[model samples]
Target: MSSAAATLKQQKEDFVSNLSGGPVGEIHAVAFVAPVAVLLWSVLQSRQSFFQRYGLLAFTVDYFLNVVAILLAKTLYSDFPLLLSLLLAVPATLVYVLPPNAVSPKRKPKVPPSADSKNKLDPLPLKPFLTSYRSFMLISTIIAILAVDFRLFPRRFAKVETWGTSLMDLGVGSFVFSAGVVAARPVLKERAEGRSMPWIRRILGSLRHSIPLLVLGIIRLLSVKGLDYAEHVSEYGVHWNFFFTLGLLPPFVAASQAALAFVPSHAALALLISGSYQMLLETTDLKAYILTAPRVDLISMNREGIYSFIGYLAIFLAGQDLGMFVIPRKLNPRSNSSAGVQRNTLIMTLAVWTGVWCGLYALSTNYKYGFALVVSRRLANLPYMLWVAAFNSALVLALCVIDSIFFPAFYNAADPKSEKEAYLTATSRILRAYNRNGLALFLLANLLTGFVNMTMNTLEANPLVTVVILVAYTLAVTSAAVLLDSYNISIRV
Candidate 1:
């Protein structure tokens, strides 16, 4: 071949190579578009139908697993632990959306039902939830330990390069789990009890109830000194955006309901919005810019922007479906049932799905251009989006099944005037407390983690001592939370 012809060929190869993270790469852009395409089709076609009618849960599980894939696509996407946050939201959303709105006729006559059950009683013995949650926690912890200590699991399986960041990720999970439980109370209560209040009243009520705590969280997040504290710790440690966003979510739910009354078929709209936004971000050359200067712009990277909103919107729509149509009208036991078989099934299903996620991540990373973020206006990647969707759904399904086994009371908290009523009522209060102080708690959690690390680093102690001290601090915080109110929020210690 002539020298000019050879140079042209080399340039073509290099172009392909850069796109695929290789010297001579082959990336199919269609692979990235398929999920969004299918999702759009599913939503548009299924507007009049229920989410369950088309196995939406299964789809959601796949979507969430794909999100984990998105996470592993590159090192840059790892900072935002969106998968874990959404996972924690699953059980809480169910608790909010699924239960009867009317007082259960099952209540005994002598019990007036006026007393607040929350302060006086323990949550009904949902041995399944406690068991499942504890088991999952223990397993996760063990997985983390093994990943850290023995290197027994594959980097593909249990590998995590960043430890401090991962621990903070766990902290976010704990806070989200606890806070969602708390928020579900009044939201669920209003649903079941048949609220006479106007839509505006409901919105205002939620704002009034939550505003104080929200303000406190905002104060912490916006503080100059707090950013200084964040600088001392990990770069992502000073995330106040979650607080502000979470503070807005309940009201957003309320507003969404109001909109539903007007639009009758808003879920389809949400799906379209999410998918279109995703597509725009991917096809455009915007990601290159976002990745270059993430800190400066809100939508530069995944700092709780439209991409995150799309996931949350999908979740909200799902919640609405379950709330309005699914939960109150019980399905077959198969929909619930937390027996050993069911639990094992969920675990295995999640494991398989997680494996699929890992595979996708590996593939997508090796060939980045093959998949793009659905939202071209934003900096989302296909793997990150898929991972969050799949992981979130798996967490939701697992929690629901587990809740079914141990917390049967959740299935039917009908009575407002019995010992059982009191028990169920307390669970609501626990929900309330978490919702009330969620932002504060999250901010506090970061501060606590950062300050510990800062102190340990300054001391320059032995590595073993640092680990021990950090663990001790974690235990102390957890113990205090439990001692304050064992069942009020999660006692993760």
Candidate 2:
């Protein structure tokens, strides 16, 4: 073979190798976590003397088996090895272990119904805003650290085409969406109250919630610019930074929400508009211009930055829509019948979302519309949006299932009379810690990443050593968040 052919073959091999941790790969990992967590929860609930006597050993053995499975799969297979492992392990555990011990009489909690119970259809309570916020932060924090310090997997894992990249993209979109949901509540309330505010006033009002974000963004931009920090050119443009995106996002989100008042399904409208713009770029030379333009021109035009912001805005709008759907309009106690109805609604919603996700995935697979068909965070095309929505909906659905099965007592635990409920609150400690100081944790991770780079040769580190370091870094950040939470010092904005 010629040299060119050899190089092409090498690149192809590398790409295939990278598939060890791609989308299917991630699904496999997620698949493993979900079942394992459920199984463990079930065992704990059983409180079986045999299990309690050897529960630690069982957990250790199970975890070891999983790690071995992952390593073997990573070494031997290029595609969906994790999925295969999950397939083998989850069914075995479910059939042989979880089924018999799924429920325990000792674990059941009995509580009186609410006195104010009225309707038979109780609304599902709104998920905490910080759940999404902390989730996004945690994922992004890990990815950001991995990118700079010890890459646990192949470089392709971090490439724009990979599932890991998509995860980060979802994180960003979710964060923006969470904020948009919070900001829109008052605006929605005011509108509902028959208070008519001018469009400009509404926009400004929406932006006020972003003041802390704007300030942080500006500070980060200045620090990065002044210090000549190592930059990921493809993440933003050559001259643009993430802070600029954050700073610009509020106004766009505000504008989009304002438009929502006029256009039903405004999030969908934004998606359509952004998707069209991305298609136009794909079909013409405009994309080339933005990507390859001179720095002066790029900075002045804000070409990629502007387009990406539009995509982000669409994602934020979608998040807002999702928030409105999931969060209850009011928090009132209801009868068991009402709670059952809410649970059924959630199940139905999850089913619908699953179908939607399958359809979108199939469409993207079958149809080729150039770059529009591909998932690109920079472009924020239709496929990417669909993927984000699908993934998030699936996550929420999974949480709902977990809540219903393993920890039903935790729901509405705040009722003073419901003292027999589980000790676990709706918000777990780790989640609460991270949520209370998400921005602080993010900033802390960035600073620590920079420090590590300065102090050690991260690129040259052993992969195992890198993994250890990342674990330490994660623990350190988590500890800080927990400490802050203990003090009730939440660093918002």
User: Largest TM-score belongs to which candidate?
Assistant: 2
Worst 10 residues of 1 by lDDT: 18-27
lDDT for position 446 in model 1:
56
lDDT of 1 by residue, 1-493 (tens): 5675455444422321111121101111211222222232222222212222224453344233322222222112223234433443354345444443343344312233345455333222232222223223222332232122211211222211222112323322323333333333454456557775688887887786457556755675666354343221112223434445456666766666566555654334344444565565557754344344445554443343433444454434433332222222222233555434444554565456546544554454454654532211122234333333334334444454444443345334443334344333322222222223333333445556555533433233454554455345434433343334444444221
* lDDT (Cα, tens digit) per residue for candidate 2, span 205-252: 757656766677667667766655544555566556565666676666
Q: For every model shown, what is its TM-score relative to the native structure?
A: 0.48, 0.72
Clashing pairs in 2: none
Show the lowest summed lDDT stretch of 10 residues, model 2: 69-78
List the candidate 2 regions with Cα displacement exceeding 4 Å: 1-137, 161-198, 282-284, 298-302, 329-337, 368-372, 410-423
Off by over 4 Å in 1: 1-188, 196-199, 222-227, 232-240, 262-270, 283-289, 293-386, 399-444, 458-463, 486-493
What C-alpha lDDT values do all the predictions have?
0.37, 0.53
Model 1, TM vs. native: 0.48
TM-score, candidate 2, is 0.72
